[model samples]
Target chain A: MHTSKVLVHNRDRSEIESEENYLPLNVLRLSKRFGGIHALNEVTFNIEEKSIISLIGPNGAGKTTFINVVTGTYPPEAGMIYFQGQNITGLPAHKIASLGIGRTFQLQELFLSLTVLENAMVGCHTRGRAGMFAAGLRIHPAKADEKRLREEAMENLKMIGLEQRASDSISSLPLGERKLVGMARALGMRPKLLMLDEPVAGLAAHEIENLVRLIHSLIDRGLTLFIVEHNMPFVMSISERVIVLDEGFKIAEGPPDDVRANEKVIKAYLGE
Target chain B: MKNSEIDRTHIPFIIMIAVIILLPIIIPSAYIISVMVFVAVYGVLALGMGILIGHAGLFSLAHPVWFGLGAYISGILAARGWVSPGIGIIVSAFFVALISYIIGAPILRLRGYYLACATFALLLIAQIAGGQLTNITGGHEGLLGIPPLSLGGFVFQTDLHYYFLSWALCIGCFWFCSNLIHSRVGRAIRSFHDSEIASKSMGVNIPKYKLQLFILTSVMASLAGSIFCFYLCFTVPSFFGFHLLVELLMMIVIGGIGSIQGPLIGSFVILWLRELIHIYFGKIFPVMTGEVDSIFFGILIIIVLIFMPRGLAGWVEQSFNLGRRTYAYFKGPGA
Candidate 1:
């Protein structure tokens, strides 16, 4: 299959060696089939720390399915996943999250009843070491931890330009601000890897521009980002590498420039 | 809508604690003191219910099972000299927590209508046990000679003394539940209420939090029940019947579900209304009867539900927000 397709700029040996400098996150022979349909078929990829990777595809192209598998939302029927050289296959979503994987939903799932600060506090659950009894009783350690947590939450909110909205209930926030809050919550978890599902989808161009800047800021802070997005321009501008899938099969893999020019990717889109 | 300047969360608690503490001094009657004592007891029970229903958003009416079980357990144990009042109270709370954990394990797995029905059935079963188990429970006649709770040589015999004791316990419970709602567990409970799937995905063990809240609330309810039995120096299985269960449930609703103030406000409103109607109508207008008061309270509850769906706490919060707006308006555009 590799020979049948025209080789589109495969990495040189020196470049591949340099790329492997950081620990590689491995998705091994992953396959997920729902009855007669295969959402992801024997797809394998490696993501290194401090790199921005984009998963691009047409509708029903299993971009989301791949994200789900990586994030442990969907347990792969056959495969292994290793994060930082440790096996994380078949771990539950929250366990995966606690293991330094953070995620934002396609549609934001916020604590509508709680204030913005409180919503971010929920994300700090894993980092908290206070026992429930101690917290309930407001013991000295619990109080100190709470003060630190509130400060951390505030710092994250400030980072997202939402410090003023801290006490405001999340239900009242606009969609763009809510998206920012979701990102802030994920940030509060102190993740080594952050997966964002369409962070700028359904936003105005200006909002999308703002989100692009925010993503870049997070990347600058040394967060590994895997973004699933439909806005090709936004993905192309920031993504260091791109993986294209069509009908659950890897169609092309290269730099954004190469992937953008690939005939197979163009054909997959045109066929839709 | 972005008025995040003020912290109004604890205002209701402050006002409530003030009103309850000053109630006896203002009322100035032995009979009224007795009524206030009952209000404090009701406050304790409602506070427990408030934690589960208000904070955790678990719709349960199993107050009587916990309350009655604690009352009977502590009463029987203390009366038999198995333990002193202090130890018995501690043991009662512990036993209630244990029982709630066992019962909640099975019942909490069921949600919505199934949960309500299951707990309702549990209440019925407790009521039946109270009626049929004559040898141990004294059946409908109830257990008698429940010794008064004493800290040393000092027993709470008078309504004045019991009222102080009850309010002290009420304060302790209020502090505990308030602190809990602000804790990580409290947030987890609220998280489950808001979004169970999201909570699970956040590394919160859903069943563990639910059971923890259930057991905690159960222990609180039973502690109140045991204290009530001790204070009255009399116990009857019927004292913790379905009627009391409904009343306790109504307290959470009338006060405001999910708000900490709901239970205390609900208990006062309910108990006061009942007493007012009982004294004035039953004594003066004999034909009105206590049954009329039940109907009256029912109408009031319906009205509250129709107009103020968020209950009294919501109303107070609305007005408080309005007050802030008015203040801002008076401050003018320049300020």
Candidate 2:
């Protein structure tokens, strides 16, 4: 085991070397309120290049709110979000996704009626360069692009070990399989930034282990990940930096060891 | 059914062409051919309704208003000789798409019963306006002496000729709609229908896709309306009435909502039932009772709903699924 602390907040020679060519990916500062409840307050976070960051909190800690605001699912009324160093506060979700960010839902939102392959192909929406009218007319270029999309979609399914099940309807799949299919669909977009909302939620322990290893493998391939999870042990083992929230306010931020030992985070979980 | 699964939509169109080709060969009745022409016309109209209500989950009630708009616009243009019949059809479909794009944006924001009410009222308003505005629509008497559709140099004069033309148009429209339903946007529409909020989070441009589909379906409806005027050589206010709108819905529900073949199948079944009811009941029942077609239609809708909530198209799919499962089970230990 590599028992080393890669302090993301601190600067080292290699870290500075990497940062010199670093492009700003995503920066968020948000405070959201609903009537008498402060759902999220003065929350600020940054996702750097090639990092796997975990957001951990108890129930109602607004972990999802943070993801929603950053991904353009929910517009934050009080603060701004910057993607790729440019302000992208209130752009539509699809526009934000087209800018290289992709996501999967907590409950696994697969197109249930469509086949697994077709569902994955929907991710190629922005990537397809050919016009729909040309495709309808079956022009040579559009036909070629469609063939390419089908092949790429199959390749993506194979990435998640679902290539054999490509023709099966999503509704025929079990819950764990559907979750994997959802991840496969997001991966089909060839996204630079992937935000997974509770990717392993409700899975069996064995399934969770498989998923964690897969995610680690993906991160090693240079994809950046921001995950919202309640699985603290997994978060501590894999995440470089852990951010803890209680009632929508950031309570602590440090290395996994520091976050795991933080008294306030311990209190927040124990109290809930 | 195995090979048919990939092109299940082509089944009804193929069956329809076969029937139309055989009808003249076997029956040789001019009146029946005219009735067959209505079936083709209704089939086209029902497909437009099916695309919106079935595939897109729009539950629109303003479909007939678009259809009527097409009829009146094309009728007025061709009747006055201001434009050729072909140009009249194009202009009519264009206005319907344009108007739906403008009005559908705000109105489609409402869902379910409220949406139904808003669109139903819209159809009612168009019907009334068409009747009241004598100068433009020709009011109660309707537009008469609309020019016949001509292709190249040949005029479509006979009922047999019109039947072939109408069915050809129906085939073209069906092909267009089936292609749309299989397109990428069609998949997005189905995803939106499954879960609107989830689709939103997944970066689907929901409102834009919804509005575009609405306009597209309206244009289809208008084209069907244009075809109707071409066949009839005249247009009447009653032809654009509310009952026809309800009938179109009935055809879609009986056939299958989202499945491409359902609309044509449902319309064929309904038209045959109506003919059967009229032949029997018109002879047996008293004049005070009107025609028994309405009652038969009501019963058919209820029976189909009770037995097949997914509609006839769904039933066809279910059977195919069962067959596939059985085949897989035999091929392996367990499927």
Candidate 3:
């Protein structure tokens, strides 16, 4: 049986501990099995606030499974997930999201009928206080709340350089711009932890560059980023630490350079 | 789509409402006004079903059940002298909301065909009860003597009077539904229509939202039913079964499924078409009965699906946008 493997590169910055520096995401021995196959087995990691962490692996690696479990898309078969020190194991997707975990899909699951701004407004549902009665009747508080949400959604679109496209329907947007719209929608949630699954996949070089810049800007705005990407240069340049997985196991863990050079990770990606 | 004051988009809706208001006065015929009242009642049903089927991507055949139950509740209560027709309408809406909420919690979890089947079964069961529950419902003899709705010394006794009430109910439902679709709740419902996983990732409680929509639409149907009962002053056990459900579906589909305007338009067309069928086709096809009605609608739905897949509302939107485009083209860029 393949148990566990961890290669830690203890940076000097870990010594500078403070009350605000507590780990925002901590996954311990998380395991998810899809029938006879182990999508993720005993995967453990922690992410600090305001830093970018990349999860890289081969085609069958459990990066998406990890995200699905963390976001409560699927109940983990084993282990626990702690977000801001609260045990969020097996919570419903919406409950976990309300606790400040926002995610963008790899393939982009935008609301096709809504405009870009309206799509972002859907992301602000948890922050809304208006019920069906109030909204149906267009009462005062509901109107005020809706106005605030629209402004918030507009702000997010502006942050992602999509204010011009706010009125455009999402299905009409190009793939790269749609990816950015996905980011803008997620930003509407005001999440402390933002997870982006393959933000640069299928994007042109210029779009990738824009995304890289936007990714850094997100960290500056005080968000912790968890990215699953195949673009090595983008991941290596952006990630402070990179975790590698293969065959449902954590094969390598450290800075991007170390993982790039690791024998096991090289074998996992290239061949024996 | 912005709801700002003096929005240009609202002009058409305002004009449409104006037409509705002036319709009875302009026509001056008892028969036309009577048909308009039916259109208004069906308008409420279709609007409720429109939001569910078009925006939310849900299918349920139980709308007729909600409408029937509402008519029965208000009619039975008022007939028994237990309450006023006004209070009965209120109580009927409340109970429909509550009953649908509880039933929808489990039933709404079933998606697509399963949901349709479940709701259809519910309609059948309620229809059977209306026929079987003899002592209370008057059974096959039908429930009669349902008094008209009154408000503080004002009694609605005439077709013209009921026409206003019914149309007001329909327009009011449209106003609320329109506001809802453009609001946070509306977007939340539409979000799941395309991508459930994406909506869920954004912290949308899918089941909760679905159930809430189910409840709201059920209440709308109930109101339509309540109005129908009072307008007729009688309701048969066979009323509001599959035929009524198909009529509501036809209204939404013919008008357009997604836009509230589509169904509003659809309800009018359908009621008028039914009148035509009754006047002309009823004379020609003397052998026609319940079976012919189904075939008529089935073929009508197929024709609409083939030629006007988006329905009349969609066609209206397309031409509206096209007109705007042409105007802008002649006006030049950035005008």
Best by DockQ: 3
lDDT by residue for model 2 (A1-272), tens: 12222232222323433554544354434777777777788777777767888899999898888777777877876665666555677888888877778888888877777789988877766566554355445566566667777888888888788899999988889888899988887876778788888888788989888888888878877788888898777888878888898898999988899988889999999974
- Kindly list the interface RMSD, in angstroms, of each predicted candidate in the order they appear: 1.7, 2.3, 0.8
Q: Candidate 1: lDDT over CA atoms? A: 0.81
Q: Which structure among the candidates has the greatest TM-score?
A: 3
lDDT tens digits, residues B142-237, model 2?
788898887677888899988888888778778766766676656667777876755665556888888987887788778778878888877878
Model 3 agreement with the true structure over A1-272: per-residue lDDT tens digits:
23332212112122223236557888877899999999999898889989999999999899998899999999998777878867798999999999999999999889998899999898888888798889989898789889999999999999889999899988789999999999988988899999999999999999998998998898999999999999999999999999999988999999999999899999999897
Task: Give a tens-digit lDDT track for model 3, residues B203-226.
Answer: 889998899999999999998999
Candidate 1 residue runs with Cα over 4 Å from true position: A1-24, A31-42, A58-76, A244-253, A257-272, B1-22, B283-290
Decreasing DockQ order of the candidates: 3, 1, 2
Worst 10 residues of 2 chain B by lDDT: B286-295
Query: Clashing residue pairs, candidate 3?
Result: none
The best candidate in terms of lDDT: 3
**Residue A211 lDDT in candidate 1:** 83
> Model 1 over residues B1-335: C-alpha lDDT tens digits?
32441246456557767876788778879988888788888888898888777667777888888989888888888888889987888898998888898899989998877888898899899989988988887788878877788878787778888888888778778877887788766776787788765565566667777898788878878888887888887788778887898788788888888788678889989999888788778887698676877788789889889988888988899899999999989999788
DockQ score of each predicted structure, in the order shown:
0.41, 0.35, 0.77
RMSD of 2: 5.8
